[model samples]
Target: MGEKQPNEQLATWFVRSGWSKGELARQVNRRARQIGASHISTDTSRVRRWLDGESPREPIPKILSDLFSERFGSLVTIEDLGLKAVPNLAPGSGVDLPWNGSQTVQLISDYSRSDLMLNRRGFLGTSLALTAGSALIEPMQRWLAPAPASGGLPTGALATARGGRPPTGRISPPELALLESTVRMFRQWDAQNGGGLRRKAVVGQLHEVCDLLQETYPADVTRRLFQTTAQLAHLAGWMSYDIGMHPSAQKYYVLALHAAKEAGDRPFGALILSDMCRQMIHLNRSSDALELVHLAQYGSRDTATARTSALMHALEARAYANLGEVNKCYRAARLAEDSFTDISVPLEQEPDWITFFSEAELNAENAHSYRDLSYHAGRSEVYALQAQPVMERAVELFAQDPDHQRSYALNLIGMSSVHLLQKQPEEAAASAQQALEIAIRIRSERVNTRVRKTTAAATDEFRGVAEVIELRDRVKQELPEYTRNQAV
Candidate 1:
């Protein structure tokens, strides 16, 4: 037996009018239909099998050849059908185009489409770090710190509508339709499942909508849409981070931040900043994360919502905990708790974004913060127990709507980590394994990273167990290179 070459298959098809196997199958089915053959059928899977060198069932192969010959007005053989292979027929391996205006448009369109496809499942498997290298970052840095705007929006007209949609009109029909669709979709998914399943799609769709809005709407209308879109994008990015597409996720976060600024929503901007900082903490860049938290605090100062303030403080506590600054972590955690004291006030007083925050939610966050501090302080028992209840609550809340895969994944990771700390190796392994399965299904790097960390810790406690060792090894193999280093 020998390996079959792809080019050989492609070449066979080239001489027969360059029709692909799938195309040939369609032709065969069509010809069969003309002949009044009963039960005529063709499918991608069968065509793919033929392309892989399997012989066709019966009259199908000859029928396909005849159909192609008739269509092309010449003799067509199976060999000429290029069924074996072709020299340059690799999927997604097209030649690169020159960077220009046209290319940029194509890039944006293709990227959007790719994102849409990928979001339907999990994070796109490809790494964005290589693509978003220093080259991209340098320009982005320059743009972020542009000299005082000369009577222009911070990001220039990038945020404004170019001619696509008028900025005013009592919620134009199309705009209302779009808004309702987005809200309904998001709420439905959030309620039914969790963020894991819908986060990527939500974000990708929001980005696409934002792109369209920028191309069409007026400033005021665009700004409002942009704000909501940015929030969706932020959630998508968070889900991406949760699932494990750090590079692309970071890009989305940055874009969301810019969108938030354009909408003149400082609170939302601060919230995103806090989220970005949390990612840094996960990466062990605690010092850098601390700085980001400070920035978030500064940006959110004038925010009227107690929940928003509490969220910022909670983020600060996470950074401090990561830094091993127990006192600072406690102080920040306490600030977060105090902020929630006024959360019971009138709903109108709270910001739209922070309206989801409640006393139970704040308590859950506090519990997690304490657990983080405990981890840094080497108080395993206390950390394990303190984190248990809140983690349980999160799981319960998230499970109420199974579609929120991202939140479910996060809670699972947290619970797994706590179980590991309690030296419950079996329970820890089970939790970690479940999380890993979800992570793999969604192709999320963040969830994988968390699972890897927890599994490694658990493995140390059950070094002699074969199942534990095997699971640990599998997790180690699955984690990204960057995460492996951080876990160590």
Candidate 2:
């Protein structure tokens, strides 16, 4: 038989609806229940077949039609959803949305719907649902390319060519202040309370801000508006990452990148790139992370202030750490520290989003870089001991700030790892125990992840010690999957 035709139209609609095939299946079952019908095998597999152009028989076709119609907030038909064999319908195939306000609005709307409503996990082929339809990390030039003449944005907010003047219905100072304040609060909540608290509400707020940007504003206010929007997008991205939603997190980061570029805040754009580097490192794509660091460097260009420069090098140190390039990591670390010395007013003058980058963060990167280096060079007491003081200092700093509960907990775990490597099982257990206290109180899974690693280290090298064993048991109780990965 000849190959079956693919229905890109239905795929787009599926992405727009923010519904995964599995979600579609589940919704269909519920809608079926409303009609008092039972026994339908409307699983993801069946939905996949329909996407591949197999017609659904009779009632189910109409049922699917209704489901998508409600999701996209418009009429949909069996034909639209590929219930019948059909050709691609959405014009020439491409996922790139031209840089404009309406496109940006739709992007955020679809992303929010997918995240808040569908809570989608994997979207493999759809542009509307996943990165498949999104641009991968682009070069700095693409991001820093000339802004549109009209406010330098496709969604032109009439900017002042000379002295800044207010436009009618322009974004007021108070409104911009509120946006900045919201991002600040969200940042605090993310560090102290956990990203899970009202994250969906933040996404909702992003939509509101996105709507605000659609309107024209003064040149000065527009710049501030873009800056504010970028920060919120970054927050949305960070929260999504904290909860293990990698795809959604990446989308938010990309949106943040665009917003920063649109704002013409070169420093903020570099910051976004640095943030992306961190995410890439987490995903184990060190090479990609390195590229993002370079992009960040280029984005900063000549106008990079001392604080921004410090952050860039510090972020580079992290990527180097991931690559196990010890010498390069050290070089970057030194540059970061040196750059910090040049900053004026330091954290007080730095952007709120980046104000948290201090000695503690630098120390953490050092500890991680050295730990990774030791893995390849053969473990040494000297290596472990050196990392200890850095981690201890970091832990001290984070611990003093109660709102940074998760960071404090993870740093404690980092300290415990060094102690473990040095054969100080008692110290290791105590440090891990302290970390556990914070982990239990916070909602971050990442904090739990660190504790699990600490538990693994304790059990692997010092199984005979009672305190170590006790620590392991407690960790297992806290994270049920903690029992499965005991490998060193």
Candidate 3:
């Protein structure tokens, strides 16, 4: 018989096995656990990867095949499972990498060691230019899709303190260092390059950190750690938005929001939701975005600091602008501005999470809102010019801080794109090149995509210019294969 086609054979097997994707994952995980592989967190994407001819790394394939064989009363080799060699899964592919359950556990166990290395001053350079493309963004987009409305709280709601121990009690100093270090690395990558490249690594790291924090830390520490992790996750999600990964980014943001809530940090939680709303606006789901912004504002009313409240209002203004609600946008923008009046006082007692939002940051946000409104009203020239200086200052102020990298990169990219639109090729190319350099250093797909878009736009303006052509070609060459595949 001829070799079975990939999709048909996989579909047939799925149908014949009387197993849903979730069931398969559960079975695989259960078997792996019985075999002492306790680190497995199997999900639908794992099954999807198998269907796509991607095999699990290490003993996972063997274990999974064995589990299936035992149940089916048939010999099921790795080949039968369509995994002879590990297929090159994309960044978000659900397949377990070389690390199986055991390895995962080991990695988490050794988190402290890694944390020490990561947190060392100036451990990683901050100049690598990363790229963000559709590949990164699409997954985030899917993840960020609006959750179905329900009366009760979500499944991942906070629970009472377990075992009469605090969630953060188990965290070692080294582990804390690791968390801070990773956050720093991600921030630097985001600022210099864009969110595209560093986002995946940040998310993965956040997940690992979250797992460790939950298992080992005491309550207060766990709460704080989770809040930080959630913030990183949300930033990753925002990068996902820049690269068009709406769904996956959405999921990360939602998860981050939940994490913030679990930390009893309502302000941070609201900030995350507001960030999600920003993504919704980018996706042109303006109405949905506005609703989310409102939800954030309402939820955060009690505890939100001036900076946080300003950010929420600014985000709401952006969404309103996107929807062409000029009056509403203006109102929100004015509120955002007013919120900033008290920013300095709050900064003295500011939480760690909102420390990045200073007066300059507030001004930048105001500029961003104006830019958005201007763009919507077809006054692009004025807004575009106004945005440039504000964003430039913002980037300059944030340059030294790794935590603000993603935001800086984003603003730079936006500023560069605007420059391109304004026919300022030299400025555009310079900004694009700087962003590209940052994107390369960071491991984010979304930042790369934004760079690509900026470069692509620049190409339109500088078609015959050698520098622009060279830059465009370089970006094209640097784009990840998966991104190129999606584009094709």
Candidate 4:
């Protein structure tokens, strides 16, 4: 050839992946989105240009390294692409786990520092591939293999333990108790308010907790303190996801998992995995979600309480529903239902976090599982018929708890959508209006989004029937102000 190709490495991967230039471009665009890139316009021409001697920019090269690394089972970097690299940069290896107490704490502390100080885009861009084999799998595998000891302090933890920095006092039980109560309060607020509004405060709270973790504590103190910290991090990660800050959510969840491992609490670790399943399911990564759900159940087999195990199985049902595996969904659902036989024990014995795993909550989860099948499996008629009754049951169960106004509201919305799928316009309108009333009162984007889904449903099915028209108009008219109130 008169001139050798500039990106022979990329070309080789393109061929090996059997991807067209357009396909490669598409993959890169999706990769860009994983890091919150909103304006990328990568296309076939971009790929061709890259292969024609034009080097990619700072993030693209880093992004491609992740893409090809996942694809080819090897680390492929900017230099590998035969392109001039960004000055003094190489592909980053992701979180390595299985370290003893010292290393694990250091890993999380360093992550928070980088998280707080680094450019948000670049920081998120690097960690987007946590789902890739190396980042998530290895750490989870290490955690699952053997539980570490319960209360080992980090190196020099004792010497640094005396200063309290939030407003300098030592990390004491009262301090730990305050964090616990704060997380508990946030949980109730999350139900009433939703994750979007509360996520920033939760993130800041987690930063404070991480600061406390840098200092040393005695064994019993470390155990309880770290466990509480893990819970706080999980809450922060969860709220981050609800706000749609997905990469940041992933970061906090990874930190939570590390802290949970350090706390030597297998059950809580399982719970963190279960919490992660929610984000994974929302992202449409059902395969990964399924893996996580099973991991949650298996990892906590010995330690997770019955209600907790039931919740894990229920989560598995949702993952299977996404995969269109109806039988598995029902099977896991039944196990979840069966796991709730004992419910009257002292709440303190179990993490108060699982308090939401009440009968109503399990029914709500089952309702979602059925709802998921109806939405995604193309067996809508059959599944919607099943989902309507389950959702109705969930509504009834929720009504038993006066404080459960949020889940009750959501379940009714779910029922309305199921009714619309089943072609019951009258029932759908009644349920939608009720849900709208709930949405009007709650400060939650999630509630509004659900109502909007019903609005879209009625609009799409336009028979110009008085009921459908009226319901659709009401939702559309109200949603604009409602969404503005919440999102803003």
- Listed in order, each prediction's TM-score against the native is 0.59, 0.74, 0.56, 0.73
- lDDT (tens digit, per residue) of candidate 2 on 117-177: 4442222111222222014554334776676655454344543433344465555578678
Q: Pairs clashing in candidate 4? A: 157-216, 164-168, 164-169
lDDT of 4 by residue, 1-488 (tens): 66645777777776787778897888777766655565767988888888876777757877777567545534455566675545432222354544565555565555555555542443442544335334465566566755433234322333333342231326666877887899888888777666756655665676677667666666557666677767877877776555444555676777777777767788888988898887777666788788777788888888888889889999999999988898999999999988887555766776778888777788878888988898786647888878777788888887676665677788888888888888888888888888888777766555676777676677678557688788878877876632111221
Go through the candidates in order and give each one's C-alpha lDDT: 0.59, 0.68, 0.59, 0.70
lDDT of 3 by residue, 27-83 (tens): 767655543456767899977876765646655766555555434533344555565
- Candidate 3 off by > 4 Å: 1-244, 345-349, 378-382, 385-388, 395-406, 461-471, 477-488
lDDT of 1: 0.59
Candidate 1 residue-wise lDDT, 1-488, digit = tens: 68654445534554446676677667667655543453769877777666665666545544555455435433344445554222323332222222122223233345456676643322232222312223333333322332234222323333333433343334575865677467556745543343445664575667566555535345556466657766766766665665445544565666666656656677887877777777766655677677776777776577636788888888788888777787888899889889877576686676545655555456556667767767787856876687788777876676564554655676677777777677777777777777776666553445565677667667767888676787788776765443211210
**Residue-level error in angstroms, candidate 3, position 285:** 1.9
Judging by lDDT against the true structure, name the best candidate: 4
**What TM-score number comes out for model 1?**
0.59
Error of 3 at 338 (Å): 3.0
- As for TM-score, the candidate ahead, 1 or 3, is 1
